[model samples]
Target: MDDLLAQFVIEAAELTQQAAEDLLALDCEPGNRARLDSAFRAIHTLKGSVGLFDLAPMQGALHSAEDLLDLAIKDNVELDPTRIDPILAVLEWIDRCVQHLQRVGTLPPTAEDEGAKLVLWLASGRAVTPAPSPVAGGTLPQWAAKLFDANPAIHRNGAVALRYTPAPECFFSGDDPISLMAGVPELVFARISTRENWRDPAEFDPFRSNLIFEAISMAKRADIEAIFRLIPDQIAIAHDATTDPSELPAESHETTTRTIRVDLARIDDIVGLVGELLTAKNGMSALVTQAQLLDGGLALSRNVAALQQDIGRLVAQLQRAATDVRMVPLGDTLRRLSRLVREISGQTGKPLQLVVTGGEIEADKTIVDGLYEPLLHIIRNAVDHGIEPEEQRQIAGKPAKGTISVSARQVGHRIELAVGDDGRGIELGHIRSTALARGLISAEAAAALGESDCLELLFAPGFSTSETVSDLSGRGVGMDAVRSSVRRLGGKVTISSAVGTGTTIVLSLPTSFAMSRVILVTVAGEQYGVPMESIAETVRIPASAITQVRSNEAFALRDRTIPILRLGDIVGSGAPGRSEEMLLVLEIGASALGLVVDGIGERFETLLRPPAGLLRAVRGILGTTVLGDGRIIMVLDLEALLA
Candidate 1:
C-alpha cells in the first residue's frame, strides 16, 4: 500500500461510515436538514476522493447516490424511508469494494455490473418494484423473465431493456460485447447466453463468439443505442419504462487546539519501547542489591535506590502517557454498529430502535477493534431470535418497535459492555430441551440444573433455541461465537434473562492488555505471577486445615468449601509439604479455588509480553514479565489453569 492508497482506504472507510450513519438517521427523520446535508457532503466528498484512483465504478455509483441525496435536500424529491435503500446499498457496496481494493490492489471483476445496477436504481428514484408476473405476457418478454429472476432487484419503473446479438465472428474484429454492455448508461442488469441451440461437449468450438447479451438500463433509448452503435445491425432494444414512485440538539463547543493524525503502528512501537524500558528499570534492583555488599554499602545502596525511585516515577508517567495515547472511546465502535442494527431491522421487517449510552468510556485500541465482531453476532441474534414479531409484541403488551440498548461503563481497571434487548427473553426450559435433544447433556443433568446453570447452556457450542435458521442467525453459532471472541480478549461473558421480559449479555474485559497487575508467588523456588484481579484474597492456613474430599483436597474459607490445588503440581514441579500452607484464593465466576504456593511476594504492575518460544504452547501461562530481581517469570492465566 503506497502512502496515497493507504490514505484513501482510511478516508474512504471513515466517509462511508459517516454517510451510512447519516443516511440511517435521515431515514427516520426525513425532515431533518442537518442529517440530510451531512450525508450529502459525505457522499460528495467520497465521490471526489474516489476519482483520484482508477475506480470509475465506485466513483459513478457514489455520484449517482450524491445526486439522489441532492434531490432530497433541494425538496425536488421526498426522502421517504424506503427511498434511502438504494443510497445505503450503494454505500455498503462501496465499502466492500474499498476493502477489496485495500487487500487485493484492485476492484472486484463484478464491480461494473454491480455499480450499474445501483446507478440505475438511483436513477429510478429507488422506487419499490412490483413482483414480476408469474407468466410471460405481451408486455413481459421471455428473455426478461430470466433476467428478472436472476436479478430480482432490477427496477422496472421506466427501465429500458436491451438485447444484443453480435455476429458470430465479432470477437475477431476487436469487439467486446460484455464491455459494450458495461458502458451502457444507467445499466441496471444484464445477462449473457448462447445465441444458437446447444451443441454437444465433444463438438464444441474453442472460440466462435456465439453469445447474446441482454441488459436493463434506465438510460434513454438514444444513450443505450450509442453504446452499440458499431454493431447496430446486431442489437434490439425495448422500452418498458414507467413513472417511478419516489437530528438533534446543538451542544456548546469550546475552541480546542488543532490535532494531527498519527498512524497506530507508530504508537504501538512507542509502547513496545516503553515496555523494554520498564524491564531495564527492573534490572536496576539487582544493581542495588549488589551495591549493598560493597564496603560503603549502606550509603551507596541508599543513593542508588533513590536514583532508581526517581527513574521509576518518570517511567510511571511515561507508561501513563503511552497508554492514554492508545485509548479510544467506545463511541467509534457503536457508531459503526448502528448501521448493522438498522440493516437487520429492515431485513427482518421488525421495527427497532437502538439505544446507546456511556460511549465516552475509553479502552485499548485492540479491545475496541476486536469488540466489533462479537457485538455484531450478539446484536444479530437479539433481533432474529430475541425480538418477537409485531403482532406477538402487540399481544404481549409491548411496544410495536423493539429496542436494543448497547451500554458501556468503566469498573475499576475493566470495561463492562452490556447489550440488552426488550423482546422475548430466552426460555430456560427451551434451552434445557435443546441441550438434551442435541445430546449435549443427559436428561438427569438437565433436570438437576438451576436457572443460572441452564442459562449457561446458551453459550455451549451448537446450542440454540431457534427452531428454524435464517440468514441472520440460527445453527447455534451466535452466542457460542460471542463467548469465544470475548474469551480470546481475556473477557468474561454472562447472560441474564427474565421470561416475558428481556435478555441482556454483559462483557467484562480489562482496560488494556499491555500492562497487568499481578501478585508474585513462588512454587518450588520457581517464581510465577498471578493476575491480582483474579485473586479474591491471600490466606495462610495450617497444613492440618486441608481435608480430603473424595478425590480432591478441600479447605473451608468463610464457611464455604473451596477446592485447594498445589500450584507446583499443576505446573509439573511438585514441592515438598511444609508445616503451614500458603494459598492464593482465586475467584473465577461463581467458583472459588485455593492455589497453594511456597511463598507470597510483592504485588507489582508491569508490562506483560505475550508468551513466545516454548512458552507459547503452555496452557496456563498468560504471558511473561521481568521481575525486580532481573529474572523472567511466567504469568499464570488463572482461568485457563483452573479450567
Candidate 2:
C-alpha cells in the first residue's frame, strides 16, 4: 500500500506538469482543440486518482476544473485570460495538496476551504451541473444474472464487469490472482475458471497461471479503475452495463509496463557509490604507473594495466548510466515560466509574447531544479525592466507586442541557456550615473568603465536604476541572486546588450553536477583541476613571448591579446614557473585568459564533492576531488577566480 501511494505521488506530479503545459499551450493557441482535450483528460485522470484516496478537497477542485474544461470543449466556449487564472489556480492548489500529502499522508485542514473557493470561482464563470451517477441496477451478464436472481434483494447501485486473465508466468512475478479479486470492494459475485483446458495431472505445471477471473462490483468506476490501475492490460471494465456482458470488448493484450519510483535518497546513494568507484579506479591506475617505475615490476605492471583499463571503462559506463537517470528535458522547467510570464504581463499591463526553443535539451535534474528561481528572476526582469511599453515600442518603429525568448542547447559538455528580449536595451549612460550616485562606483571609475564593466554593476548588491520600488523591480536583489545561484552550481552568467537593439543573458553550466571531465594541472607544485568545458587551448610559451600591457601581463594569441595570470601567484602557492611555461587558455564569456602553470597533466572524468565548513565560503574553488593516487585536488572556479 505504501509503495502504491508513492507511485501515485510520482504519477500525480507528472500529470500536473503535463496539465500545466497543455493549459499554457491552450491559452496561446486557442484554436488547438487537441491541446484542450489533452488538458481535460489530464485533469479527469487526476480527479479519478485522487478520489481513491482520502483527498476529497483535491477531488472536488479537480472535478470542478474538469467540468469547466468540458464546457469549453462541448460548447466551444472561449476561455479568456480571466477564466484561465482559475483553472491555473486549481492546478497550483493541486500541487500544494500533493505536497502536503507527500509530507503527512493527508491533506491540510485549510484545503477544504481553499478548494471550495476555487470550485465556486470556476463554477461562477460557466454553468456546470454535476454529472449524474451511473444508472442503478443495470443489466447483468448471463453468468451474473443467475447469481442476482438467487439473491433478489441484493441492491447494487453500479455494476462493473471485469474479465481478468492472469499471465502464464504471473505467479513468479508475485501475483496472486485470487487474492487480488478477493480485495475488490462491494464484490457481489465472482467466478474463477481456467483460461485453457486443464492438462493431465502428470503434465500439470503448478507454477504457471492460466486463470480467468470474472467479477461484479457495486463500486464506482473510479474505484474499480484504481484497484486495477497497475495492471490495466489484464482487465477489461464495463461500467453500469446497460447491455449484455458478452458485448464487452476483449481485454487489451498489450503488456503493462511501469517505471519504478525510486526514492531520491536511493539515487543519491548510488551516485555516491559511483564516485567512490571512480576514485578507486583512478587509484589503481596510479598504482600501475608506480609499478612501471620499479625494476622487476614491469611485467606485473603490464598485466595490471590491462585490468585497470577494463575497470576504468566499466566505471565510465556506470557513471554515464547513473547520470542519465537524473537527466530531465528542459521543456518541463520552461513550461512553468509560461505561467509567470502571463501573470506579470497582466499585472504590468504590458503585452508580451514568450517564445521558447531547444526545449528538448536535457540536463541533470538537480541543475534543472535549481534553475527555477534564477530563471524566474531573469524572466521577470525582462518583462518588467527590459521590455518597453506598447506605445513606446510603436513610437520606436517596433511592434506593439514585445517578445521574450528563452532557449537552451548542449554546448559540448555544458548546457547553454539564454533569455533574451527584443525590447529597448539597457542604457549604459543611465547605469553609469546610477552607479555613481548610489556610491557603488567612484565617479572617476564610472566614467572610465567600458560597456561590459558598466553592465557588471547591475549585478552589484542593491544597484538598481529604478527611482521607486514596485511589485516587480527596485528591490535590487534579482540579478545578484541570479549570479550567486549560478556560481554555486559551478556555472557562469553573462549579460550582453546593445544601446537600442536588445539584451541577452546567457548561462553556461555543466551537463551534470555528479561528475565532470577536467584537465589536471600543477600550480605551485600542487595539482588542481580545470573543467574541460572552460578550456580553449593549451600552448607552451617562452619567457620572451610575455608582454606588458600597462600594468597587466598579457600575450597575443591568434591575433587576440589575452591576459596572463600565474596560477601560483593567484593561489599564493609560489612564483611562476621557469623561462618556458605551459599556458592554459580559458574562455570566460567573450574574453579569454591565459593561466601559467608549472605543468599540464592528462584529462579525465572525476566526481565532484561539495566543500565543507570554511571551504564553502572560499572563492576561486568550486569543489574538491580525490585523484587516482589518493591525492585530493581542488576544482578551480575559473570564472570566479578571474572575477
Candidate 3:
C-alpha cells in the first residue's frame, strides 16, 4: 500500500477511537462541553481525511456525524444517550471500513449501504439529509472568508463559495477539473492553491492532480452543483452571507501532541536485534577469560576486561532502550474494551458503567494486544451472566445500573490487572452443578474442593455455567481461553468472588515478555535456566538435613518445612550424589518448594523465546535462551513443574 493510505488507516482508527471515547463520556455527562467539542473535531477531521480518498460513503457518514455534533455544540441540543448511540455506531462503522481498507486496499462492498444506514441514523434528529445543503444567507464559511481576504476584488455579498478538491487520480479519468470550474456560471474570482506540500522536483508526477480550486460565483448553488455534477463528493458550495469570519460556526481547535505511528513488527525486529547484541556482549566476557590463560596475557586480559565493562554498559543501555520501545500504555486497550463494554451493555439492555483506573501502567505491546481478546470474553460474560437484571438488582437493594471496572498496577516486574464488576458474583453451587453436568469434575471431587479450587475449575476447557447458548458466552470457551492466553504470555490468572457481591479476576503478567532474568543451573551435567522471579533464594544444605516424611522429602529452612523436589529426578536425570546440596527455594503463589540442582551458575538477563514446534507440547519448560557460547538452554517453568 502507498504511504498515504497506510497512514490513513492508522489515523482513521485513532480518530474513531477518540470519538468513541468522547461520545461515551458525553453519554454520561451531556453537559461536558469540552468532550462534546472534542468529539466534533475528531469526526470533522476524520471526514476531511476520508474526503482525500475514494471513500465517499465514509465521508458522507462522517459529514453527517460532524453536522450533528456541530448542531449540538452551537444550537445547545442535549446530547443525551439517544443521540450518542448512533454517532458511536457511525464511528464503529467507520472503524470497520478502515480495517477493511487496510486489509484489501479499499472499503468493503457493503460500505455504501452501511454508511447510508449510519448517516440516516445520525440525521434522524434533523429534517436535512447527510449531504451539505445551501446555508442560509447570514453566515459565510471560514474558507469563503479567507478567499475574499486573499482576493480583494471579489464580490462577497450573495456569492456562492465553492471549494473544489479534485481527486489525485482525477487527471487519469479524463476529467479536466479546470474546465469544469471554468463552466461555473457567472464566476467572478478564483484562487488555485497546492492541496499538499510539493514533492521533490525530480520525483514529482505531473499526472497526479495536486491543486485545490477556490472560487466565488454569482451563480446559484444548484447551478454550481450542476457544473461539478460528476465530482459532487469533491466539491463544497456555500452561500457567502456575512463578511465577518467570526460569524461562521465556531470549531474547537485542539493542540495536537507530536507523535508517530510505528508498526509493531518493526519494534519486534528491534527487540530481536537487541537480543543478538546481548548475546554478542556476553561472548566478550568469555573472550576476556580466555585471554588470561595465554602466556603474557595478564595485561591483555586486564585491558580486555576494562573494554568489556565499557561495552557491557553500552549494551545494557541499548537493551533498556529497546525494551522501553516495546512498552506501551494499557490505556488504549482499556479504552477500547470500555467501548466493548458499552456495546455489550447495549445489546443486553443492561445499564452499565465502566470505570477504568491505572490505565497509564505500561506493559509489553504483545501483552497489551493479547489482553483484548481475553478481556473481551470476560466483559461479555460479565454483562451476560454476572450482572443481574435491573428489576432483580432493585429487589436485591442494589443500584439499577451495573458497573464494570478495570484497574491496573505494577508490582516489581509484573503487572496486576484486575477486571471486576458490581453484579451477581459467581455461585459456588452453580459452578459445581455445571462442572458435574459436563463431567468436568467428579461429584466426590467437587465435595472435597474448596472455594478457590472450585473457581479454578472455571478456567477448565469446556467448563461453563451458562444454561443456554447465545451470541455471548454459553458453549464454554471463555475463561479457559483467558487462562491459555495469559499462560502463553508468561502470565497467571486467578479469580475471587463473593456469593452475591461480585467477581474479580486478576491477571499477573510479566512487564516484558522478550527478556527475562534467569539463574543458570547445571542438572546432571546439562545446563538449564530457572526464572529468577519464581525463586525466593538459593541455599546450601547438607545431605543429612533432608528428612523423609511418608515417602516424600522435606527440608527445614527458617522454621518452615518446605517440600523438596529434585530437578534431576523431574527431568528424568538421575540424582547426583553430593555431600553438599544446592537448593533453590521457589515461591509460586501460596506453594513453596525446594528444587535441588547439581550446581548454580551466574545470573543472566536474556531473551526467552517461546517454545515452538515439538517443544511447544512439552511440559515444565517455559522457553529457550541462547548462551554466550551459542548453546541453547531450556528455561524451566518452575510453576508448571510444581503443578
TM-scores, in order shown? 0.59, 0.61, 0.58
- lDDT per residue, candidate 2, 128-148, as tens digits? 332111111123445456545
Clashes of 1: 2
> lDDT tens digits, residues 523-562, model 1?
8878889888789999999999999989899999989989
168 Cα displacement, candidate 3 (Å): 41
In angstroms, the error of model 3 at 175 is 48
1-643: candidate 3 lDDT, tens digit per residue: 5555765777887798799899999888888889999999899889988987998998988888888888888888667567677787677667656654653466666677667777776767432333212112234457867877777776665567889999999998898989898788888888899978899999899999999999888765556766776675677666653343342322001101123567878877887777877888888888788899999998999999898889878887887788888788887588688678878888888899998998888898888988888888888888877899999999999999999999999998899999998889999989998999999889999887788878888887788788777677764567888877787788888899997899998999988875689989999999999999889999999999999899888999999989999999989997765888999999755457899999999899898877878998999889888888888899998777766
**Residue-pair clashes per candidate:** 2, 2, 0
lDDT of 2: 0.77
Cand. 3 TM to true fold: 0.58
- Model 1 quality (TM-score): 0.59
